[model samples]
Target chain A: MNGSVLSARTLRNLLPALSLLVLLAAIFYLQPRAISYVGFNLMLNLAIPIAFATIAQMCVITVNDLDLSIGTYVGFVACIGATLLSGGIGALPFIKDLQASGALPATLPWIMNTPLAGVLVLLMGIGVYALLGALIHLRNLPSIVVTLGMSFVWLGLSVLVLPVPGGQAPGWIKSLMTLKTPFIPFPIIAAVVIAVAAHILIMKTSYGAVLRGAGGNPKAIERAGWSLLKVKMAMFALAGFFGMLAGLSLVGLTTSGDANIALRYTLLSIAGVILGGGEFVGGRISPIGAVIGAATLTLAGSFLSFMRIPPDWQIGAQGAILIIVLALRTLIDRAEKRR
Target chain B: MNAEPGFIRRLVAKPWLWAYVAAAAVWLVTILFTGGRGGGEVLTAAFTFATFSVIVGIGQLYVVTLGPGNVDLSIPATITLAGAVATKVMDTQDGLILVGLIVALACGVAVGCFNYALIIILRIPPIIATLSSSFLIQSTAIAYGRGIRIKPPAALADFTTAQVLGMPVLALCVIALAAVMEIVLRRTVYGRWVTAIGQNMRAARLAGVNVGRTRFTAYVMSAVFAGLCGYLLSGFSGGSSLSMGEEYLLTSIALVVIGGSSVAGGYSNVPGLWGAALFLFLVVTMLNTYGFGAGLRYLSTGLIIIAVIVAASARKATR
Candidate 1:
């Protein structure tokens, strides 16, 4: 019995990496050209933004709450990163005249283009999410409803900032994201760094244990003299911070912004969390596994494209992948119980 | 004994009262802006559009009433697939209206079963299961219709648009349907089982309630209602498009919440559904009439929803 339990635990931990490796192998087999560094860069660079988004989602899931607005919020941040952070709000209709008439300088280099201004704006966005967490706790409201409502607010803000998706990502962000390393792809290095940092923060700290305890047994945490509300707010703010990272990275890659861009990330991030062995109600999550899961999902898309699947069927294929992975999880869980 | 409050106070204490009051206030504000012009026409339009919201909102309400972490995110996809299949099969033939209706309901049943199977059998969470299933359903819709917009049969379209005494016939029919459902919710054993399971699944099981079956029926019922809405909406709009069901996703959940239904489950406000639906439709119309941009409109909608939820919960807390 002890041996079976140990094996099950090991298998559960290994699934994410194993799935990723198998997928990579399949891709390598399908196209030998994809085995090189350049091909990997082309395939995995987009996974960077997805990995960030999944981490953001895992943060919220850590506190046993979900953020339905994360996708729209990311789009809003991308709008800001492209327009306001880039030193021009030229794309907005009302501000266009101000920019043209020289009333507002063509670029506010010292004031808006600086990294300080961007960081401040992203911090304010995180503050908004923290406030949302406070509201949900104070009123005893459901996170799903509150976040669903907030999605519209973010979507509206995104549109107001960049109405037609024409703003440019700042030069520094683009350069940083595309920075070449010695051997491996930049995205892989970034993913590894993110996963390691998040794992250290969440799985190797005392506060992290308190936060998870707040989700699993709030009464006990309260009895232990910790504030559940504060933990929830911190989780939400952390999620918002990562969401900002995701949006900025996405804009850096695309070099543009749109109100509706990244809207699908809401669902995609949730799938990534589950695919990484996160649970809905237990506050169970793995940061490293989630990043790997996000990369795997992104690679799955490329794999399908390499297989010549039509774009129309790709959505269905994604759905099928989610179902199959979850089905496998169920089988493993049952085996674990039987042991 | 203390004196009982007056009738007005009693009415105000009811949770569903605020939705009706809000609906009336919004309608009045819009009418005042128009200087009373087209007031009847506006009411007619509100009823017609609110009918669709009510149809799907009822289903969503049931699913939500199954407790926290229970929601049908595949509703929009289910509606789309049903509409696509029904229209493509009917092929604009008036005589095959019944056949189309059956086929749409069948699609709903299939989707509901698949969604539940993912949730129960595979042990996936309801939200994720429905969301993933929706992708599959939407892809099937795309493959089947190839983005074709098939017009409804002329007879069916005409019937859907038909009105009597300035009110839509479809609206009246749905009103009756809501009434019947209210009875089922309050008087039937199945309804009580749903309430019990939502309140406490373990306790309900010990009390001999068939928790799984009750939850299953609620989900299936929700999907079936979505199917009906798709069938009717396609006829009303004159065709079925891939994007036709898009708006219903948020609209369904919004209406259910605004209608005074408890998101925590176990409590449902049937009467409030109509009031909330009409209020939502009028809120959009009011914003459009005032010439507000889409950004402002959406912002206000989100703010207003948050305000309503706060007020509702505050009232419950105080009581």
Candidate 2:
């Protein structure tokens, strides 16, 4: 395609994101100076994790499947990451000897002691979530029910891992998310990298085409000699991978892991995905759109908070937005079909 | 002696029999493990769960049978409004109890009507319409009450709490409601129309079922039941608290599912749901007795629902 053709296609794809950006800008303009920066940065930073989760949700919803356990997976990862990075149970039995004289673990390798342990923790988190997805597929369970069950299981695990939600991520991690050397925080950079990678993997690859085809018509794909099971498994694994990244981002921003963090993300992420123009029955998704949707939701939250709406009212607002988005999508789809 | 038993034949023929059996088994296990608590405590808890579950379950059943992807996500909101309205009305005097009930029912009916308008007139999907209505109702209730808890009148409280034959009056109310629903869903022309619509919308419309009116009536009935449940819960709890109806959202769906209603719509079982409600309460009470705590209770319930759905799916696949 020529440059003009590419540009036009890109513009068509970006309509949803652009609309959301306009909304964010409006919100920013309405806010007073003192709190505006706080609101803008807070929303931008918050969007990172939510955007990742929304992308994950979009992938599953694209396949006409719902994973209610994304929130649970996030909680599991956060708790696990916190425990691993914080070290075991205040002081390990062997570490107690070194700590007796107010000394750290001198014999341990630097990699074991540093925040780099987060990589291993992230792997574990992804593994656990993928295993859950596998179980759902193996049992041929409805993704909604299986994930709903997994949420509870993950909650139990979170409680077991971090009973009181006091475990903290390394100081460097928090700084990475909040500190801005120029105009953007490190987490946003990380999100962009992930988003670009995901976009390329989903849009540019044969696997992406096959996945989209499978989503649109799994039976047709199966009859065409494609492995539906493999497609589903891969989709779920991808969702888990994104969920783990979101969890890490959350931990980085919060500086601590709370079991309760996962509770709202499930619904919020679904809302974000839908708002981003990601079709629930599968096919097209833009990472940029997911980010925009997350940004819009975060701005809405900040706006509501600024208006001094009560906590319950915040939930009501989110619910209202979800319904409106769904309604609009249905109407749009009907119109398109009519055309 | 050669003839098969009538009851056995009937039980075998009933589609929901297996659901009832499954629920009964769970209930028995729960009672056994909990060592069959004191009669009064067990009765109160059982009655409370039964009444609450039936009210919510009936609403869900209506939505499930309404077809066109119907499911009332606004049930919790309807219940909340009903509770709030009932409490406010009952605050006047003993003479206003009947008036309170009327007001609660009316509020619920209005919500149902609004839901119908949104879905039918505005052409929104049922799920979307109900969900938005729920949010609107919740926000309105919270803003209006300012999160205040309204105390129920003495007579209303007595109505909820009082027992006949060592059982709470609520249990009898639920049973009566279930019987009425069974007759409404099974014997009436409206019931036949509902089933026909659910089975095939185009065919039903062609056959002169007045599809839109049937759907609207079903939703209205669902909301009224939800309202009644909310009013009873407020009286039972001695007051209406903000977001008190929230817990019923999942529980109602769980009850309907366990009772052999497909979430996709077109089928339901009131008796099965009643049994499931009893089973859920028993399991919850047992879990409490075993000191599993609130977190575990939530986990167990979620897992059970998933397991049931998966099992149902697997069974369907085999068939």
Which candidate has the highest lDDT of all? 1
Model 1 regions more than 4 Å off: A88-91, A98-119, B1-10
Q: In candidate 2 chain A, where is summed lDDT lowest over 10 consecutive residues? A: A88-97
Q: Which one wins on TM-score?
A: 1
True contacts kept of each: 0.63, 0.42
Per-candidate interface DockQ score: 0.71, 0.36
- Cα error of candidate 2 at position B282, Å: 1.0
TM-scores, each model vs. reference: 0.95, 0.85
Model 2 residue A168 lDDT score = 74
lDDT of model 2, residue B8: 83
Tens digits of lDDT, candidate 1, A1-339: 899989988988888888889889999889989867888889999898899999999998887888888989999899888877876434444577677887888775454445556557778999999998889877888888888889888888888777788688889999988989889989889999989998998889999888778778888999999988898898888899899999999999999989889988998899888888788877789999999989988888778878887667766877887788788878888999987
